[model samples]
Target chain A: MSETTILRTEQLKKSYEKGKYILNNFTFSIQKGEVVVIVGPSGCGKSTFLRCLNLLEPIDSGSIYLEEQLISAKDKNASKIREKIGMVFQSYDLFPHKTILDNLLLAPVKVQKRNKKEVEQEAEELNKKKIELDLEFRKEEFLSKTTIWWPETKGCNR
Target chain B: MRDMGISVLFQGNNFVRLLIGLLASLRIAAIAMALSVVFGVLVGMMMRSKHGWIRFLCRCYLEVVRIMPQLVLLFLVYFGAAKHLGIDMSGEVAAILVFTFWGAAEMGDLVRSSLISIPKHQYDSGYALGLTKWQVTVHIIIPQTVKRLLPSGVNLLTRMIKTTSLVVLIGVVEVVKVGKQIIDASRYTVPTSALWVYGAIFLLYFIICYPFSKLATSLERHRKEESV
Candidate 1:
């Protein structure tokens, strides 16, 4: 089976001020169900690139396509396009006023207008399974704990 | 019995007059504050408008109110408007109009600054969650802005209450005006009537304003604790 390209950006260009491009001629394509990591030094446009993908920051010039649809066009609905993309921030920006469950269900329930009861049930089941796995991993790690002799600590002056 | 300055408050119908006057002040302040807050929030939202002309217009209004004295504004509305524009505005109406204008400007500035102070990440996060701009503003931005706006709003209310004394100068017989009346009436009979009457007026203002000041302080402290 051939892999499908989910997202494709062509000759992307973005600048804060005139003639100063943060994302100059950037081009990339991501396949469906494939993990792509963006790594770069400080001041690089990693975050800006991600923001531009969702139209959080407007690109100066480029074409971004989600599958076959041209999403970066002027009249394209950014909010609807953003609904299909899920992003996790380095610093968790969860709504402080909402509970963890509500935070998880907010977009699905409110934006997608999904059935609340169904989403809630699924989320609860997922949370329970995650907690169970975490506990089992902790137990295994504890059971496999071993003591290592430190010859250097004993020989060195205290 | 000549130096009955403060004691004139207890004189015949003087106490009742002062109470009525204070009630009048409270009534005007309450109505003006409510209108100010409603109009102020609208103006504040306008100040953050994407349109440069809208922002410029709002900024001009804000600067005029903030730079000019409240007394001057009161005079402008009461004397200038009535004389030049041929509008028959009562003293109370003029006072309410001027204060609303002034208070709205102050409140608008407060709302603008508080809304601006919220981190950019909040909007980004809300957008990333697929919330529309209006939905993000209504659900996420407004709640936080309200929390931050409370202390300053309370402070502005208190300031408006205190500033209501300026209405007396415009011939509105509010608390200070009544106090002046009492002093004038007792000037010949009582030697220190002015002191007592003015002291009572001062106490009336302090009584009205002190609680609001305390409320503002507590609100600010509570916000700090929550943030920490």
Candidate 2:
């Protein structure tokens, strides 16, 4: 893999039980600015593989590298690594209890410890784009705001 | 001032004694309910643990509390412990301990079910934002859980208050015990005083328990409408 490969997993092995390998020797790498989709039949380890990429699932045998840094190590800081890799779900469910602005502000302000005023001001620019996007979108929460907020997060746009 | 047995209820300090006894019952129930919420939330969170031993321990605790009656738990803590372990604990303390054990178990189950009622993706969404486990729990998960859990908690408090009547058997000077004392004292002069005093005790319990149930139902309705 080239140095620009942001996420790489080598010889990945995972199983729910011994000798029943769901993911066996799955070596894959994605380069920067590449949008690659992995499609397969159900229970073909697609979701599990995606989960393992973000450290949500642990690999039984193999290694995961994010920008050539070993993030799959047991002792590495998971939150720090996960901050650099954002995963959106199929449902697009934002925190329903919070307002749209609060949902956008949560990671940047709380996780990154950034200045609220600066973050709010930065987000205001996105709000204009969001308004334009909303004109074509259905009036549903799942699709409306979360799509706009996705770009504000780092590494997600990569 | 008629010599009938009904007058035996409100005569002099007899009324004061009933009020004091009711306060004692409320005190114990309130304390136990508070402790239950604190410990119950902890147990509920722990029930979702991935470790085998922790989940096993939580399951065993819940089953034991379910199979064994709350009164039996009280006796084990109060009389049995005093007899065998020489703990010499007081009735109120024992009642609090037993009630908290039972209440926490019930409340923990309530919390667990309410937690599961939320969609599974919310946790994944929070964690994917690079928020720590505790951050997602405290900031994202628990606020929603508390909003859903409150009505059931208020309902549980009323049940706890009614069950506090059981503590009188352990020799606590609760409302019913004092009512029994009043009836026994007037037994000779007013032979039918047991009916009046016991009736008065029932009225006191009704007055305390009814409003709580009304509030719970109203809150429950609001919760249902909002959840949609």
Best by DockQ: 2
What are the lDDT scores of the predictions, listed in order? 0.81, 0.86
Question: Candidate 2 has which clashing residue pairs, if any?
Answer: none
Q: What stretches of model 2 exceed 4 Å from their correct place?
A: A1-3, A17-22, A134-141, A152-158, B1-5
Across B24-114, the per-residue lDDT of candidate 2 in tens digits comes to 9999999999999999998887887788899789889999999998889999999998999999999999999998999898898888888
Poorest 10 consecutive residues by lDDT, candidate 2 chain B? B1-10
Clashes of 1: 3
- TM-scores of the models, in the given order? 0.86, 0.88
Per-residue lDDT of candidate 2, residues A86-156 (tens digit) = 77666666787888778889998988899988888877887777777887666655465666666634322
lDDT of 1: 0.81
Worst-scoring 10-residue span by lDDT in model 1 chain B: B1-10
Per-candidate alpha-carbon RMSD to the true structure: 8.9, 3.0
Q: Fnat per model, in the order given?
A: 0.63, 0.73
Cα deviation in Å at residue B223, candidate 1?
0.4
